[model samples]
Target: MTVTEKDRDILARTLWGEARGEGLAGQIAVAWAIRNRVDDGKLKSWWGEGYSGVCQAPYQFSCWNKNDPNYAYLSGAMAIPFRELAQCRGVADQVTDGRVPDPTGGATHYYAIAMPKAPAWAAKARQTLKLGGHVFFKGVP
Candidate 1:
């Protein structure tokens, strides 16, 4: 697969119904799981940072697990890539660095996004932004 920017955009549009901001963020989070997190690599950081920027937190996927409440709430939603609906609802610790079996019998990649901004993170980002923080997000294919 080429996995070009255009491909990402189309995939986002197809999945999310619209095609930018939180909508694109939702799909890109899924793609990030498939592209960078499904395994592990320098590319992982790219997706992690991208997810964090859009959703407004310093999201890191490795920390998510089934034991956590945040993970439980986010799993079903991220698995299907919803819009800003996943935004700012707590530590939305969605994962984008693993795979799960498909109902049809296949393993699919995963990615995560966090919501409601965990206290530590929200505080830190708030402070930084207060001091002038610059944020950026990747464009989908």
Candidate 2:
């Protein structure tokens, strides 16, 4: 549970990529989902090793995908807006440091409400929260 700077950076970038438009609360929820994955003892293998591992794991968060529009910014190939990234970094630090309560209610998965249709997995999972433009869920099958 020792979060390194790499972990913080990756988590911050992930928040920036995934939920920047949703603002601080939304970003915090997303961060908790990643943290939940990191802290899940039962599914550790599936989620990868830690914050960086889980964020960069293949096909989990679409922003990490090479073809995604956010990839360049998230990967540092393109510069992210300073104020936005700083806000995301603050959320990342608070979430990773256990300073913020999980608004996602132990959610390990989420999808933008703007999607044409919810992901198939969402049907099997328990919905936790609906905040900003996303829906949070846990116990995804």
Candidate 3:
């Protein structure tokens, strides 16, 4: 897919919001998950159109949810820490441009390992990769 500047920025913001503390590999894993969603062939609406669409799709990435603590930084209501945001942006660019491989093995979903419990969708899905604090999954309905 041809990634525009807007898509790149949105992906970067999503990485910053979702996995900033997880470092570069974590950010790339998250990016792969988002790209996997874009290629899922299920969501055909604006929500699945491209990088921006997949990242902003409601409930897909919790960081964009109104109730999420990261929403403020993601929506520009609060300032993201400069260094963290820059790192996310750099990773976003690399992932989108194919400089990094899909380390998550086409995973379309993931959750932080610290979560009290894995979501129901993860119960039967194929675990693809584990990087930093998150675990990636695929083949979920």
Candidate 4:
């Protein structure tokens, strides 16, 4: 897929919102999850068309949700930290260009360990990786 600047920017913002505190490895894992969705032929329609579409798909990434706290910064209502966003941008570029390896082992789903309770879907999902504050999974039913 030809990733547009908007795609890269949204992907970077997603990484910043979702995994900025988790550092480079965590951000990479999150990026791979998005990429997995982008590359999955089975659920192409479900995941939206490409990077931008997938990231902005309704209720997919919470950072894009209108009520989400991160939405303010992601939508430009607030400002993001320059250094952190820059790092996320670098990770986004690498992952989208296929330079970074799939650290989540093809995971298409993940949730932070900080959540009060795991999401219901996680119980039916096969766990693929556990890194930083998030648990990665695949084959979710």
- Compare the candidates by lDDT and give the number of the best one: 4
Candidate 3, residues 44-79: lDDT per residue as tens digits?
Answer: 474568899889887788899999999999999999
Write model 2 residue lDDT over 1-141, tens digit each, in one string: 789999999999999999999988899999999999999988777888899999999989999999999999997899999999999999999999899999999999999999999999998999999999999999998
Candidates' TM-scores?
Answer: 0.22, 0.98, 0.93, 0.97
Candidate 3 stretches with Cα past 4 Å from truth are none
What is candidate 4's TM-score against the reference?
Answer: 0.97
lDDT ranking, best first = 4, 2, 3, 1
Residue 94's C-alpha lDDT in candidate 1? 24
Point out the higher-scoring one by TM-score: 1 or 3. Answer: 3
lDDT tens digits, residues 64-135, model 4?
999999999999889999998999999999999999799898899999999999999999999999999999
lDDT of 1 by residue, 1-141 (tens): 223343333233222321123343444344443333323344544443233322222343332344544453344434534434333111122223223221211112321223333333332222111101112122221
Candidate 1 Cα errors over 4 Å, as ranges: 1-21, 37-59, 62-69, 75-141
Which candidate do you rate higher for TM-score, 3 or 4?
Answer: 4
Question: Per-residue lDDT for 87 in model 3?
Answer: 90
Clashing pairs in 2: none
Clashes of 1: 18
Clashes of 3: 0
| lDDT for model 2 | 0.94
